[model samples]
Target: MLNRDWHKTYRMPEHPTLDQRVDWHLAHAIACGCREMPDTIKREIEKRGLAVPERNRPN
Candidate 1:
């Protein structure tokens, strides 16, 4: 479960349900592992201003 308050730290609005956020986060995690993003997924994360933490970046 995600901490609701953590959204503020991520600069993510709480408008979307937690399930929606989790879904996107999971997809993003997969993308990060590959060290590549398709245009569509790239745009989604950019629109949300989500940053891939260094820890999550492909090693």
Candidate 2:
């Protein structure tokens, strides 16, 4: 099982921006083995003119 509260353990940047938060979530989600990406991450990616990739699942 994944730890949903993992994000709370980190010290957020002094001026936390949307991109920073999205990066944090993306890292934690990957560490927790989440196959689906969050909406925030998706938005961040699109905002930077990037394409959405397929979800990665562990075997």
Candidate 3:
């Protein structure tokens, strides 16, 4: 149910669809959460110019 504006915000111009952009970001976010990134995944998101907010999601 993605609307045009939502699509616009999430879509990457270089990518074919918003889903592609979302998939990339989701992987990045997961990397951030993988044992807090420092002890696990490489920190590429900061290089990509993103600062993921450290807010815990409600269960």
Clashes of each: 0, 0, 0
Residues 1-59 of candidate 1 have per-residue lDDT tens digits of: 13333333344345866546545565545444334444555566566677543324544
How close to the true structure is residue 48 of candidate 1, measured as C-alpha lDDT? 69
**Residues forming the 10-long window of minimal summed lDDT in candidate 2:** 1-10
TM-scores of the candidates are 0.32, 0.42, 0.28
What is the C-alpha lDDT profile of model 2 across 15-50, one tens digit per residue? 979878666555654555354676877888888887
Give the best candidate by TM-score: 2
Residue 18 in candidate 1 has what lDDT?
57
Across 1-59, the per-residue lDDT of candidate 3 in tens digits comes to: 22344445554458436445444455434433222333111344454566644522223
Candidate 3 off by > 4 Å? 1-13, 32-59
- In order, the Cα lDDT scores of the candidates are 0.48, 0.62, 0.41
